[model samples]
Target: MAAPKEIPLDEIQWHDPFEIQRIGGLHSNTVLFYFASSPFFDGTSNNAIVYNQAVHNENMNHLIHTREAFEGRLREMTGLEFMVAQEPAESGPGMGTGVWVIHKQTRRKREPKDEIIVHAAYYLVGDHIYMAPSFSDIVNHTMITITEKLSKCFAIADKARTWSPSTGHGYNTASATTSAKAHALESKGTTPMPNTQESSTSEAKKPTRSAVDSRLAEHSFMIHMQYGGEYMDENPITGKPGEFHLSSTGRKDKMPTLALPSLNTTMVSSSLTQPDKKDAKAGEKTPKTPTGMSKIKRKKSKAGATPTSA
Candidate 1:
């Protein structure tokens, strides 16, 4: 093998991963590629075809779409299970991703540039099922970083010989879900928990938190209110009745206390001792009745009722 040529950074043709649909290149053994880097396009063609991962591929504005379309044709010609990358590396956010694209005709007002269309014939070499992406642009080229990655990929591909299942392409452990979570944590590179038994025990026993579903106290209360719970005490304008302290956000709930300000005492015998008057007031027509007291409140009309007001 000849020495790998160094790719210049500025000469890379950039593409956006978000523009393609499920876009990612596949090994000859038919495994979809995860993006460790981006694609590149210089003025001339080379062994390196740059691309990205299988995320953020709804937009197809560049040559990446063209590459994607070519890969689709490759899949059709090869019968390989493959798609385009949806996104590039984690760094690709906000930053652009390179992709190849296809457009039928420019608007009639603007004269269109020279368009390339691909037609194909299928031939099977070995165990490889060569199919293609059903589009025009074959490969979306991006930057030199991806070009270098592509060169590495080609070298690896060449050393292993054919795009066969034995190459261990499917067994990529670098960016799997659990490993990805671990890798993401590793990249931030914080210190591990203290090695004391209590700390280690606590860390080991801790449950994975629901980051998306977790809510602030107020947010939880608001959600509770949305479902018909009233938070009258939470209003800043109308403070809660008496001694309750506000939350950090200045919200409050009702506070309970035994002592009444007006009475200055608690009712001890209210239910047990005052059954008669309370039952009477409550309109319970009981088994027993008093001779003078009736169920109705008969206003003693100016008759025998003594007036003793000062």
Candidate 2:
């Protein structure tokens, strides 16, 4: 196929690729999470990232340094940096701490919690990325459903998800994990209601076997970050963009969303139980889904789409 007219490189960055994403009705600062699958960007040799507001300090620091070095190491490797525009690194009004400028540029989905909710994951296999039913979204910082179309541009694969017991964290943690309250209970010895029920459930779910077989144990693949996944693929007409395609198309022409699925719950022992909780208050009213969320967004090809300012 013939390439598009060669526009001057300088003319391009000013507004070159000629593509943009549109997100309406969102709060000015909403994260554009799990949302990339670009044609012009993917064809190049650079490997890039998918991002969310939850970026961690370590990953951010690593990216800045890596990008600086990528300039000099192009002969050996290619890398890129990404960040969701809304969550650009800014000084605080957060968890009692502010991020230094150096930590804001790397586009990694930083998780604030130490709670490693789900361990059973599909990491890279010999050279393939695992395919799954659905994955977590960095946009809303939540999980979304998956489709067959997007699976193509990726080397689909999976792995066994595993986790440490009584992780002492969120809903995914088993009752066997921690105290009912954020802190230890008083000497009263008598625990509260929800915690009491959770303790009982945990006691019954503990597994007797030392190991359990899971899909995450069987496959693996290299990582690529784009929120769109294979459904947004352009190279493969159908699915599964094999290694040959990956070598041919660098990060720009070939990347999927940076997202994964997490198990909602884990079993625990009565002695190790804790409560399952969320940020929202109990029995409180919930907000209605806005019009924008009525349908899942699908990606369009470069030949037909126009870029939106937002």
Tens digit of lDDT per residue, candidate 2, span 200-277? 789668753222222222222222243326554445453365634323233455567777654233322321353344
Model 2 lowest lDDT segment of ten: 99-108
List candidate 1 stretches off by more than 4 Å.
Answer: 1-205, 208-213, 216-219, 222-310
Question: What is the C-alpha local distance difference test score of candidate 2?
Answer: 0.32
TM-score of each: 0.13, 0.14
The lDDT of model 1 is 0.39
After superposition, candidate 2 runs with Cα above 4 Å error: 1-4, 13-22, 25-79, 84-310
Q: Deviation in angstroms for 290 in model 2?
A: 99
lDDT of 1 by residue, 12-102 (tens): 3333344223443332212222221233212121111223322234342242445455454333222112233232333356764333121
Q: Return the lDDT, model 2, position 260.
A: 66
> How accurate locally is residue 100 in candidate 1, as Cα lDDT from 0 to 100?
18
